[model samples]
Target: MLLEGKIVLVTGVLTPSSIAFTCARLAQEQGATVVLTSFGRALSVTQRAARRLPTPPEVLELDVTDPEHLAALPEHLAERYGRVDGVVHAVGFAPAVCLGQEDGLFAAEWADVATAIQVSAFSLPALAKALKPLMRPRSAIVGLDFDASVAWPAYDWMGVAKAALESAARYLARDLGASDIRVNLVAAGPLKTVAARSIPGFSQIQEVWAERAPLGWDVEDPEPAARAVVALLSDWFPATTGEIVHVDGGVHAIGAAIRPPAPEPEPEPEPA
Candidate 1:
């Protein structure tokens, strides 16, 4: 019950397996009342997923790219919950072609890449700004992230977007800290969620993580990441902000382990 009585807004839940869905479930289990957001056709999907949570929450319309929707969030959230305690930004998307290939950065249209940056990166601050009024002092803002320290094989524009997200969180922490608001990102290992499955060659990243992480990993289990998110949402992280907490089973901290060399060949009888 660490989050008892908190009101949190969770976005980007497309299905039951979604990381956002797991967070919503955990939040509710800890006594927090959760609200969800989705847009367009995905709204229905999110709505369905909401019912599967421990306590079903109201699903609100939120098209992050739409100015009108962003403007309406505060009032909408106000009507749903008197005030918001935390916000979980799980939204991200990128066109297929934007993922650079071995040849080079893909020839995908720049417009698509720009869209990815805006939604995945720039949207974090925008969300904080929009929800500033609703958030209480000490309110927490958490966003989903992927480690962007190096170029991902096929992550393409989305990689750029995540880097921006990391930077954006730092700036938000600086500006919002004075307001007693906290901003942070959880850099999770890849899960087979709808969003991740959309990325090409995502399995390659998964395989590498499995081999590299000492604790081992389950690409199908998003609960570990969800729990980390809930901890940040709770009062436990009151003093922590502008940080990226890696929940990737420590994969981000080390390089792949070298394979053991084949057993030395038996010495020749002549040598004996």
Candidate 2:
């Protein structure tokens, strides 16, 4: 039990297919007591999904943008478990209009992009800060990430948000390391979750990932990614921090072209 007797908070679970749900499930199986957080209309959905876990965790109301909820989080968690050992900041969002509109690209408006940055990037440090007092020393903070190394067709603002997220984790790691708390990001391969389905042209990215990754990636299997999160949440990575661990089937390393080599000339056989 890597996480035996630990208490972990996982945010952004909207359905059974969500990446956060899988992380919570794995954490429970590893002997950790898990708690989930959701907002407004999705609270019911998250609750239903929580029941499906091996050991259903209590669902808490948390809208990352709500300062009131953020301030109440430490006390809220303390009411249930007394202290927290880890936190999974798996929340992110961006309006569809800002994704990749040709005419609207430059004029898409900063409001949407700014919201995405705040939720996907800045909220990480915010959550860490809010939960710091309740979090035990040597605790860990893990976040979900995509390969933000380059631009994808319709991943526009979200891509920029992820880039900011990667940078934010480094800063969080540096600041939190002095307190013996570790922060890291897991760059996972694509999966068909509610949040992912909301993105435009996500299928195209999924196809390219399958074609390029040498290990033959499975977009449906988010377990591997979840397992990586759980491992980082544990004590195994005691000396690790400010790192972006790539769990993308090695696709990030390979070039996009997977076409077979051209056939050799038939005349060569006759000459022999």
Count of steric clashes across candidates, in order: 0, 0
Off by over 4 Å in 2: 260-272
C-alpha lDDT (0 to 100) for residue 240 of candidate 1 = 99
How far off is model 2, as Cα RMSD? 3.0
| lDDT score of residue 133 within candidate 2 | 90
Among all windows of 10 consecutive residues in model 1, the one with the lowest summed lDDT is 99-108
* lDDT of candidate 1 over 53-140, digit per residue (tens): 8878899999898889999999988886789999999999877777645644656677988988988888888888899999889899
Instruction: Name the top lDDT candidate.
Output: 2
TM-score per prediction, in order, is 0.94, 0.94
Question: Pairing residues by index, what is the TM-score of model 1?
Answer: 0.94
Native-to-model Cα distance after best TM-score fit, residue 83 in candidate 2, in Å: 1.0
lDDT of each: 0.89, 0.90
Give the number of colliding residue pairs in candidate 2. 0
**Clashing residue pairs, backbone N/CA/C < 3 A, model 1:** none
